[model samples]
Target: MKVTSHRDEIRVSRLLGASRYRVEKPFLSEGVIYGFFGATLGLLISFLLSLYFQGPLNRFFDPVKFIESDPFFYLSVAALEIIGGILVGYFSSWLSVRRFIKF
Candidate 1:
C-alpha cells in the first residue's frame, strides 16, 4: 500500500515462509511498462474468443428471427453484455486490489 512520491519505483517480492514475504524495493517504471504488457494478454484472449466463436455462437443462438422481428432484442443483448462486462470488470478489479492491499 506504499505509493512512492517518485512514481518510477516498486517493491518486488518473494515468499520466504507462510504468511511472510521478502520485498526487494527497486526503481523501475512503477509497473506502467509491465502493466501494458500484462493488460494486452487479457485483451488478446477476449478478442480471440470473440473472433473464433462468432460463427458457432450464431448457430447456437439462432437469433435471426428475433433480429428480423425486431432489432431491439439484439440491441438489448449487446447493451446487457456491455453493462455486465463493465460491472464485472470494475468489481473484480476492486476486489483484487483490496486483497493485495490486505495481504
Candidate 2:
C-alpha cells in the first residue's frame, strides 16, 4: 500500500537521478513524523477522555470510578507509545520502500 501510494514519486525521483538513499530518506522521515504525531494525538485524546470520565460522570457510576493515574505512569505510557510508534513506522516504511525500490 505504501509502495502503491508513493510509486509515482519514487519513479520520478529515480528519473531525476536521485540516489537510493536520498530517495528513501524522505519517505522514512515522513513515516517517523506520522508515527510521532499519531501517538501524540492518541495520547491527547485518551487523556481528555480520562478527564471527562473522572468528572461529574463519576457520580452516576460511583462503584466503577476512574482510578487517578500517577503522573509518572502517564509519562511512562507516553514514552512507550512514542517508541512503539517510531519503531512500527520505521520498519513499515523500510519494508515497503525496500520491496518497491530494490537496489
lDDT of 2 by residue, 1-103 (tens): 7677888888898899999999889879878888888888888999899898876777878898567878899799899999898888888888888988875
Model 1, TM vs. native? 0.36
TM-scores of the models, in the order given: 0.36, 0.74
Which residue pairs clash within candidate 2?
none
Q: Model 1, range 51-97, lDDT digits (tens) per residue?
A: 99988888988866443457787567655655555555445544444
Candidate 1 achieves a global lDDT of: 0.47
Off by over 4 Å in 2: 5-17, 56-69
Steric collisions counted per model: 0, 0
What lDDT score goes with residue 2 in model 2? 65
